[model samples]
Target: MWSGPRNLSTAMMYSFAGRGDCAVWDEPFYAAYLKATGIAHPMADQVISAGIADPARVANACLGAIPDGKPLFYQKHMTLHMIAGFDRSFMAGLTNVFLIRHPARVIASYSKKREAPTLADIGFVQQAELFDQVADRLGAAPLVVDSADIRATPRETLGRLCAALGIPFAEGMLRWPAGPKPYDGPWAPHWYNAVHASTGFDEPEGPLPTLPDAYRALSDRALSYYERLAALRL
Candidate 1:
């Protein structure tokens, strides 16, 4: 699945990790992204040093074989982390799923830790690009799951997602043990504190994130892309 930051991607990763038949990978492309862009994200250097730094190598790892010989490999990826130079052919054999959330909620949640985020930083345009690419290559629109829909009805949403991917809906996907697992990315400490604290999807909370004046334009642009994809959601 591909998603932007603060989009409940980690929780979704945990959900999939709960399944015995699936092996989960967390942001395999991140180290390569950090190395190429030199964006000073939290723990950027550590993340790059801790994992495979070459995008091609990482792509090969993701595409070549299923590590541990699992039948299904659930890779949790960040759209922005794919970066400009990365080969997208790895996606051809993969069941690409796009996970989306409201722009206001995303911006509000993201800005709490980072300052003055741009549209590129939040990843909606990249997501739309990837979505279009996958759809064009496969001659079919890929699956899209809205975070709100997942939080509202996890079983139904996940069941539909599993059916689309041609997998059984495992009861284990509804919850998992709290705290980090073996598959967590090196940057987990910086990005996954809240998710690491939860065993299951938390009920959607709050008065939706309040969009600041500076983020309004970016949010508007993101909402356009988000709605376009959301219109096709299962």
Candidate 2:
């Protein structure tokens, strides 16, 4: 699956990991992205040191057969992590799923950790571009899931996703153990605190926060892209 940061990607990872037939990988390309771009994320040094920095190698691994002989390899990817030079051809080998959230909510939640986040940092534009590329290659619309829909009805939405992916729906996907998971990336401490605290999808909070004037345009752009994909969501 491909998604932006803070979009329940980790929670989805936990969900898939609960399945006996699936093995999960968390942001395998993130370390390569940080190394190539020199972006100073919260734990840049630690993450890079722990991962293989070559994008080619990482892409190959993503395209390789499932690891550990599992029937499914669920790779959680971040759209922004695909820097300008990263190869995208490997995407044809996998079933791509886009996870989106309201841009205003994404911006508001993201700003609490990183200030002055640009549209690139939020990743909606990159996500839309990737969605187009994958759709063009496959000659069919890919699956999309809104985070709000997952919160409201995880079982139904996830079942639809499983059906789209040609997999069986397991009730075990609805909840998971709390705290750190073995498949979490090293940077989880900085980004996954909220998800780690939960055993399942939390109830939808009220309305989204209003974006400040400084981010109004950026949020609007993101929302346009989000709505485009959301229209095709399951």
Q: What CA root-mean-square deviation does each model show from the true structure? A: 1.1, 1.1
lDDT of each: 0.89, 0.89
Residue 10 lDDT, candidate 2, scale 0-100: 87
Per-residue lDDT tens digits of candidate 1, residues 166-185?
A: 88999999999988888898
TM-score for each candidate, following the candidate numbering? 0.96, 0.97
On residues 1-234, what C-alpha lDDT tens digit does candidate 2 reach at each position? 878877888888999999888988999998999999887788899999998799999999998878889999999999998878888988888889999988888888888878888888988999999999998988998889998999998999999989988999998899898999977889888888899999998897688787789877778878889999999999
| Whole-model alpha-carbon lDDT for candidate 2 | 0.89
How many pairs of residues in model 1 come into backbone collision? Answer: 0
Off by over 4 Å in 1: none
Q: Where does candidate 2 clash, by residue pair?
A: none
